[model samples]
Target: MAEHANIPAGKGRSNAAILVACVAFVAGMVGMSFAAVPLYRMFCQVTGYNGTTQRVEQVSSVILDRTMRVTFDANVAPGLMWNFKPVEREVMPKIGETVKVHFTATNHSSEPKKGQAVFNVTPMEAAAYFNKIECFCFTDIELKPGETLDMPVVFFIDPEIVNTVETKDIGTITLSYTFYPQEETKPVAVLPAGKADGNQKL
Candidate 1:
């Protein structure tokens, strides 16, 4: 009789543990689903992967000896009222050669406004082969209404770019940019195969 009573108690304890485990499993799955968007954005930023805005601060881990992609991002303020673009559409420079690209920011706003530009390069396959000489993405950019100014990005193709046979096929490379609002921006711009018009990269 004692053994029968103990068996029932043990079974009840086992059932309670199973119920707790099931609840935990469901909660974990729900949490993962909620976190999916941010996680995906992070992946794109690191890989230039899904075209979504990236979250990586910098690309310092790439292997310089091999080939990689050189990616760039640009943003402008909405209140500033400006027309901006990278001067040069494409380039194919020798390793270690410095290249300059311009972003022409023209304020059409009726009133003078102040804003800053945020820019960065994603030297995807060429992270090691890439270096920035001058860039305006840092610090806040101040502009007056109806003012037109050119922002510059002075950079160089690392000699290591030529060392890798894969990058050799890259006779033509693209330096790209996009304008964003002053506050923190969301990855929402879906730029098509657009041209910079007359802007030239130096």
Candidate 2:
């Protein structure tokens, strides 16, 4: 009887150990799931994957003679009652030449609205070479009823873009932005106080 009892006790301890290990594994997975989004965003920012462009304060001094056409595009996500578009349809700039462009957003609804923009560039290969010094993306944009604002983006194409075999033949790159309504219940703070256009980076 004693021997039999010992066997059952040992089996119960083994089962409990297995249960604890499984729970720890599951918790670890859940933690990673929460971290996945920001991690992927950092990866995209670094590698320019999925048309993501690099952010920098300044670019190289070497300006290439080669010119490239840059097209602007804007869109609004569903449920966001706003009119958003690029002020300029297209611009021709030499490689490494910094250019500034504007996008206008108007809130057509009666109440205040908050939005954030997701941006990308194409042909996708050029994304790696497209650098932005300041942009309205990655920040909350709030607009009062009937408010219109001009958003600015300052950027340059890396002069070394010509050296990349993948983007050598690309003559045009399109920078696109899409605004989606923020789902948070509380209103997010708007851009810092500055010019009427609020072109300053926060």
How displaced is residue 45 in candidate 1, in Å? 11
Q: What is the TM-score of each candidate against the true structure?
A: 0.47, 0.86
Worst lDDT 10-window in candidate 1 = 50-59
C-alpha local distance difference test of each model: 0.56, 0.91
Model 1, residue 185: distance off in Å is: 15
TM-score of predicted model 1?
0.47
Q: For candidate 1, lDDT tens digit of each residue in 1-202? A: 4554346878899999999999999999999999998887556545444332223223333333433334443455455477776565555444455556677777777765556654334334544344555666545565677888888777665555565875556543444455554654577765444334645445
| Top candidate (lDDT) | 2
Tens digits of per-residue lDDT, candidate 2, 88-173, equal 99999899999999999999999999999999999888998999998999589999999999999999999878888998889999
Give the local distance difference test score of model 2. 0.91
CA-only RMSD, every prediction: 15.9, 10.9
